[model samples]
Structure formats: structure tokens, C-alpha cells
Target: MTEPAWKSPTDARAEFRGGLRVPTAGWCAGWTQANLIAVPRALAYDMLLYAQRNPRPCPVLDVSDPGVVSTRLFGGDLRTDLPAYRIFERGELVGEVADARAVWRDDLVAFLIGCSFTFEAALAEAGVTLRHQEMGVNVPMYRTSLRTLPAGRLGGPLVVSMRPVPASLVATAVKVTARYPAVHGAPVHVGDPRTIGVTDLDAPDFGDPVEVRPGELPVFWACGVTPQAAVMESKPDFAIGHAPGHMGITDARDSEYLVP
Candidate 1:
């Protein structure tokens, strides 16, 4: 069997065009993307509990029935819906595929979690430079010493994404993101990485590290990966998520998720 390709929802949609169904990048733009988790019905409740216990890292958006593949909540099909699916057995990555039709089970449930990419457009509009986009690399993510509130079957250290911001714009970045709590809200930590147990700014637990210049301070925010880290430690029988940077886009606008 060929290993499955993991493409973001946008890339997947673009590749679905005629003559090619391969994994491609740069699909949908400006749409809200999401992190996904699939588990057996037996463990769904506990998983939702896990999400509730850790809202910063695992905010819940939608959930499908035990055996259903249709999720109208975000207005997208769960099967042949996005560009790809990842299979994990006992916390191990077994393979990646274009679709999960072959392994669909009646007891499987899908959970959609908010992603930080939802704020990228807003940041650009504000003139905040996203180093990862400039370098054409994934955002830097680190596992912090912080502990998340534990629930039924999940608990672990917090994971955060980092972006280098010019000292002048760091404050503005916080105010802009504070408006969108559904997508991770504001900065969790700024200036020093050691305060969060991240010693080497050059190496991250996930994603590529961008350059931190003389006047720039490393800004960090709670990341969706926090839930993934928790799930790995929880050792649930099964679960799935978007390969970092990849997310499912929804019809909702960014302002819709902002707090008053």
C-alpha cells in the first residue's frame, strides 16, 4: 500500500481539480482552517472532556456521530472532504492517505478544533510580518513546561507556536490577536523562551524556527499541538489531527470568533 499524503484542506481542494488528485499546496485562502481528531464512540466522550479540560489548546468546534462522516457544522464532507487523513494506532503514525473511505468505521467520531491560521490574514492586514510565510516554512512550535488541566484521558505539557516580531510591533500583535479568542487569543509569553522551559530558540519541538533578529523578541502563543501532546501522553487507542500548519477552513469570518 502507498503511504498517504498529508495536505492542508485548501491544498487538497485545489488538487481535486481535474487531471490531478495529488497532494498540492496553496489551496483555499481566507477560510478558517481547523485541527481534526477522530476517535471511537467509546472514547468520544472522554475526548470531549479532554478538550473541555484544555480549552486553550483543544477548543471544540464540531463533532460527528459515532458512525457518520457528514459534518454540516463547518459545511464540509468528512470523507473525500479534505485533502488527506492520517492514521494513528496506539499513538504511532501508521500511514497517511488521500482518503479514509477504506477504513471508515461506524464507531468513529470526528472533532474539529480551531486553528491559529485563522488570524494570519488579520496579521498581514495589520502589517505584522509572519516570518514563517516569508521563509516558506512551517511555524515554530515548542513543548513548554506548563501543564494543562487534565481530564478523563488526556493531560500533558503545553505546546506553543513562536513568531519573531520586531520589538516595535509586539504590543500591537497582542491587541490584534486578543480580538480572536476562538483561534488561540493573545500571546502566552513574550521576550524570554527560558521562562517556558524552551532553552534553544533555534530548535523547536515542531515546525521550522524563523530568525530572531537583534531587535525582535520571540513571541509565543498556546498552540493546537498542546492537545496532540496531551493525547499522546493519554495513550488513547486512536486519534487523528492535521499535520501542523494544515487546517480545515470554515465559512465563518474572523470577527465572528472575537470576544467583545
Candidate 2:
């Protein structure tokens, strides 16, 4: 099927509703991209607490009321908004699907976590570059040894997405991204990946790697995938989340997430 060129969140979501499964990194530019996570009501409290405790990696943007697909901040259906989803059963990935409607239950709660893509364009305008976006690949993500605060049984190593920024613009990238608190703000680690437990940049546990040119630094930001890592470690009975780079583009703008 031919996909329509999407210039708006509505358009991106409409395409996703039609079974399009593309990385949302470069889509709906300037819109707030969200990491989706849905768990049964029994586990929703722990997940909510986990996000609250680890705001950088799992910033809570908008959470759905139990059994409700609609959120107060955005007008959209959560069930078919994102292009790809991963279903987990007891810490194991059971399947990848285009939509999670089949697993929807009256007691299910959905979480829309903030994404760093919300700040990438600002960094670009500030003279920082995005190698992964330039190379047309998913942003590189690694499992870090940094542990998130334990909330109930949900706790694990923090996950980070790596972006190679020019050494000259490294400070600018940090300053620009720090303004957006809802999104994972600022670079947590700005140098050697080994310092953060990543053995190799080319072998990311999630997403694709970008080149680190000479005089460039590998900048790491807390990634929303951190929750999924916790899911894998804690082995919840069931959970659903956005697949890697695929995100939910909300009606909200990136500017809305920026703090003064």
C-alpha cells in the first residue's frame, strides 16, 4: 500500500491506523512524539510510580484513565496511533503488532511517555547535527549500568539513546535540550560509552547506530525505552509498548513541553 506523505500528527496516525509500521523519528516534525506503554490496571500503579521516580528516562506526558483510550491533553485514539507495538508476557516479547486493540481490556491503562525527538529539531537549529537522522536510521540506544530508582518491582538499568554531536556544538546541544524537561532533558553522559556500560557503539541493544566523526562526541540522553528494559527485568505478566523507534506523535507541539 502506498503511504501518504504525512505533515501532521493526524496524518501520521491515520497512516498507522492503516497498518503502516515506519520509524516515527522524522515524522510529524516538531510535534511531541510519545513512547507508548500499556499495562493492566493491576500493574499500572507500579508503572506510574516508576515513571514518577525516574522522570528523565520515563517522563509522564499523558496517562490514560483505566479503560479509557482518550487522554485529556490530546485528542486521539491510543489503540491505533503508533505505527508499531511490542507485546510482552512475563518479560518476554511475545509479538510485534501494528495495533494493540486486540489486547485492549476494560482495566488497561495507557501511558504516553515523552521522547527526546521533541528536542532534536531545536538542537539542529542551534547548530548541533543529528547523524542518525541524516543517515536515515533509527537513533542508537544502549542499556546502561545506571540503575533507575526501584518503584515496587519495576526497576532496572537505565537505557539511553546516543546521538553523535560535533564537539563545537556539544554545549549548544546540551543547553537546547535541557529546556525541555518533559522530554528526557540534557545529555546524561557526553563521552566514552564504556563509562556507561556500553561495550560497543555499533552494537546497540535497540535502534541503529550513527557515525561519530572526528571531533564529534557521543551524547547520551535518558531514553523512554528504559521502562521496557524494566519490564524485561521485572517480568510483568503483560505489557505493551512502542517498538523501538516507532513512537506516537501527539497533537501537542514540542514547544508545549519546553520549560521556562
Every candidate's lDDT: 0.72, 0.88
Which is the leading candidate under lDDT?
2
Per-residue lDDT over 97-131 for candidate 2, one digit per residue giving the tens place of the 0 to 100 score: 99889976788899999999889888888977788
Summarize candidate 1's per-residue lDDT along 1-260 as a digit string, tens digits. 22122334444444432123322122244556677778888888877897888787787877887777756555655655554666676777676655666766778888888777777667777888888877877788999998988877667899998988888999888998878887788989998999999999889987787899899999998888676777677778777665566555555555677688
Q: What is the TM-score of each candidate against the true structure?
A: 0.85, 0.96
TM-score, candidate 2, is 0.96
Cα deviation of 252, candidate 2, in Å: 0.8
Top candidate when judged by TM-score against the true structure:
2
